[model samples]
Target: MADFDLEALSLSELKKMQKDVAKAISTYQDRQKAEARAKLESLARDLGYSLAELVGTATKITRAPAAAKYRHPENAAVTWSGRGRKPQWFVDALAAGNTASDLAIG
Candidate 1:
């Protein structure tokens, strides 16, 4: 049973509610850590790599083709065309050899 009315909670009651939410978040984080640790242990056994070896291997992996983040040169920075579809020059660049990926900032 609740100690206080739900509708009539004062500032102190709100503080207590916040503390309860924080405790719940802490418990959830602890549970997530436990689950991640268990998954890593199983994955390590299957891969025949220690946790440290797995991390070291992961760090060596390069970006994939689909995930490639390309950027144009700074000299290529445009004089901003006010809104709407890309300007004719931009379309021409695409039609020429430049890829949308090559122009992507991220």
Candidate 2:
């Protein structure tokens, strides 16, 4: 362990040291976790089963991007899926007395 002269360090130096120490701690923790995981995986393999088989790997279910439900009146390329917050152009069209159905794609 390297001895740091805390009393001799300036305010900026102390802050930099604090940040370095925090980063080092985080890096050390990540390394430890990786090592532990590797050990567990090796032990699991030795027991005649893979880590995923023993732990039950999570299957990520992701939805495909929503089809464009509305198209820009002026710019045909600009479109929205009618999901989440309304876009600025859509809001403007609505403000100009255009109905949602009017802006909707065929």
**What's each prediction's TM-score?**
0.43, 0.73
Candidate 2 per-residue C-alpha lDDT over 1-106 given as tens digits, one digit per residue, 9 for 90 to 100 = 8898899999999999899989999999999999999999999989999999988989999989999999998999999999999999999999999999999999
Q: Which residue pairs in candidate 2 collide?
A: none
lDDT of 2 at 3: 91
What overall lDDT, based on C-alpha atoms, would model 2 receive against the true structure? Answer: 0.96
What candidate 2 gets wrong by more than 4 Å, as runs, is 1-5, 75-77
Q: Predict model 1's lDDT versus the native.
A: 0.68
lDDT of 1 at 99: 75
- Cα TM-score of candidate 2: 0.73
Question: Model 1: per-residue lDDT, tens digit, 1-106?
Answer: 5486767888899899989989999999999999998899789989897777767644566643343233333445553232456666656667888876666655
